[model samples]
Target chain A: MDTASVTEQPVLAVIPDDGVRIVTVGLAVAIGVAYGILHWLNKRSSEESRVGAIIRHHWQPGAWILGILLVTLALPKYFTIVAITALSLLCFREFSRTTGVFREKTICAVATLGILLLNFAAIDNYSRLFFAGGALTVALLTVCTIPFDKPKGYIQRTALGTMGFLLFGYSLGYVSLLCNTPHSRLLILFLLVAVTLNDMLVFLFSAVGPKSWLLPHTSLGRTRIGALGALVVTTVLTCFSGMVLFDGTPLAALVPLLILGVGISVLGQLGDLLVAAIKRDVGIPETRPNSPNRGGLLERFDSLILVAPAYVHFLSLMLGPIGSDLPQRVITGGGP
Target chain B: MNDWDMQPAKDLHLTGIERSRSYVREAGLSESLIRWCWLCGLRNWFCRWNGLKIEGLENLPSEPPYVLIANHASHLDALVMASIVPRQHRDRMFALAAADVFFENPLTAAFAASVVNALPVWRKGNQQVGLKQMRERLQDEKSIYILFPEGARTRDGNLLPFKPGIGMLLAETGTPILPCYLNGTFESLPAHQKFPSRHPITVTVGQSIDSKQFQNRKAGWVELANTLKETIQEMSGKPAPEGLG
Candidate 1:
């Protein structure tokens, strides 16, 4: 497709009656039903079936997958950005708690302001402000602590605050950026599926494959065979999904899409491992016990953390500026 | 290079409500904001409704890692004590509230923990653990605890014999105990009254008692309690009321 056609395309034009989203929702519901039935059967047959444990553990993640699909389909493009920003804050709340940085009032205040500003930039479609937020927050945090003059945990608090902003505010802000693009729905659905599938495939392989260790210290559940299986399976799924999502763009070419897919799969797993490291370091079983069935919001969104930034940059590189054709600074008084 | 000693929040794994009520609860932005709003509203209510006049505000140490002990007569005692906490240290002030009364149910617990920034002192069970936890916090975390050594609210409008728990917390810690006396609190809102009357109340702040001189033992706790009671009695100009230890 030509550049003009790409820019002129309606947001839903590529979705084709929401075929991709429908399939995703259908697949999720089917899996959920199947698992629910199995869990019921096992409960009836035995008092303590290991299947019950598996179902309990996986239930929250399963619900989140279905929930995101439905929400993406229902919410307007702007609301989707808002929703993502809210999710970023929730995740950051858990991050602050686990990192003990919540104790630092100034750091927490600065980070929260940073998150709000980043979201504002996303909503305003002001890329300049969005890019400036991280540096500005770092500067604010550095200066914010100096007023207290405690100087005991000065460096620690500042660094923690900055990392919190980058991960939740700066990194997740890219999702809002991507969602504002012309074909955002398709792109977002593709992202959700790729990351979710990557994690699910890894679990499937690890659960059934040879009981050998991978990064036992980081994640005891993962095995070498499982890692290899996830890597290959994720690559294939990403390539296929990319083929559909990026059909008209230069990414439609096999090599670029393949690289993108593989990159997402690898990055997704790495993100999970990174969170695991945090849990282990913090000496906590889970990030937060906010939900009975699910781990913290961060746990559910862990894979997406790394995938979001990478996906936005890569797609932007392959296709020109995301949402560039959309009227820029819709709220901040600027033109496309 | 100095090692980066940063750790996750002590209550990191706790949910919102639970973290608010946690002994190790650390106030970040949200909690700090909530506490600030509560304090502002409480301050106004105290001043306008009860005619609260806080005296000896200058007596408070400019920082935390200290204890504030006052005579327990009504529920307003803790609130009155917490009101005098300097704005800078307000977020760090953990009011030691009665677990059964304030934290018996989830709703009250959420209110106490979130709005009041309270940590439950279970009057019935496992108090040693709670006192020990508070002691550790005072020493290590630089926490400021607003407590009543009288243990429970007075049945009559008179002072109760001070408990040794305060001494246990401060013994050998060298932590200063800021002895405050709240006058007319019982008249404003007695233990039995669900709603407070518009009776005037006064909070008089006195010099901090150094608990370091006392031994971390029973005899020391007795002496510490007696000294605190005497100081409060002297400030309030009321003889010690008869009560149990």
Candidate 2:
């Protein structure tokens, strides 16, 4: 396969008169305006409120802007890869900032940049060996180079860095690689839609559901009713979206997709908890004070880091090799 | 010291004597009831204040007689751990507190006995008696013992050297040690702070490591202590104790 020809060719056609195109453009503009207005209001409100002053003192606006840019640009296939790269960098930054034990920032930066390059190479249809080898080398080098001064700090930095590589680099790289596969762009978009809907439903459940003081020690602040609400909403939305977007998907595939949605939602919650766990360990409440970002890098990209890997691995199994005729068979249940 | 001798003072025609005696009794009761209530209250308040997060509660065994060993970063560690344990099991658990500190005053002693259900273990002298008492508590089929193997609050919120008492306790009791790691407690209430600041605290309980795993080891007690500290460090995502190096 000539990878250069594929990268050079434009994948999406512009539909100037299409209703979907109009709707997309209109929605984007409206969201942009709303965000601008919210930002202004937040600034004014912060100036007026004492509580907001304390918050603003600790907030990192730059990280928030970068995070928003990544999420917004991720809608386009090409930009999605860039967004993933940015996410990886931000996550690495967040991990390093909160963890005082990581003394080798230069090494961490090099390893993180290598992972991003590997991700881009994977997306551009470069040799899988290159991606795999680079990932392995980075992992090995990080583990070996960590100082032996603080045994706990050494192990923690290594473990966290390795986790970031696997989660942000390899898993996200596979998601980008999907864009090159036939009908895989639609699959990537479908995954995002399902995930967004899942997040929305979970947030709604947490906001409106009955509150329980039980397990008040947890950071989730979620009640049993809220969890049930999230589960039901995620399942229904996944199945409905599958029916609409992937009509040819077999019942077998649909079942797994439903399971995947629920699992991702749970893992997303776990991801949130994991980030909180780190903050708790470091005695830092949030990374906003140090990073100029309100939610911090870990807080913003945590769910994506966790879900991206699981989604890609599951997608690979569901849709065999990139050009294989197995996707159709699997969708139609022709054979194992 | 005698109940009958105290009754005459209670019966004396002192205008607020009854109310004062009742207040004393209530204060004593408050230690046990107030301790649990305070724990629950603090958990809720801090969860709201700093947005606390907890995970891996499922990893904790429902059965009893397990030794809960955790890193001691602050004085709040015991309260935080007790708050997370299922309410059903809280009554059966006893926290091992420094005997000199908790038993220094009569009121504190009563409160410790009633609310905390604290087992007063000597920090320095009389190791034999303290060990015997701890073993006796562990030998009971229904009792749970919570110990901070670090011996005291860490000066810098880092895991300090593990006291040999834990190794000795494990050797004698041979119970499953549930290694717990508490995060953010130092900032919430550091070593010198008398009151906890509004900071979120998280307590992670790792899988239980059986005491029998280290039984009869030829190596020194530091080896077992290192293993236990490493277990907690892994759970907390912190560096292991420096002494292991």
What shift in Å separates residue A198 of candidate 2 from its native position after superposition?
A: 2.5
Residue B68 of model 1 has an lDDT of 86
Over the true interface, candidate 2 deviates by an RMSD, in Å, of 28.6
**CAPRI accuracy category, model 1:** acceptable
Model 2 segments beyond 4 Å from truth?
A1-78, A142-153, A183-185, A213-215, A218-220, A251-254, A286-293, A322-336, B1-245
lDDT of 1 by residue, B1-245 (tens): 35767687676556666665678877667767888888888888999998899888888888778888888899888887787788888877889988888887888888888788899888786678878877888888788889898888888867788888778778889988889989989998887899889999999989988889999999998899889988988898877655644
DockQ of 1: 0.47
lDDT of 2 by residue, A146-238 (tens): 444434445455665565556556655666555545554455545544444444344345434566522334444445665667677666655
Error of 2 at B140 (Å): 50
Candidate 1 lDDT by residue in tens digits, A147-235: 76688877787887888888877888888887666667767766776777676666656656787978877776568887888899777
- The fraction of correct interface contacts reproduced by each prediction comes to 0.64, 0.00
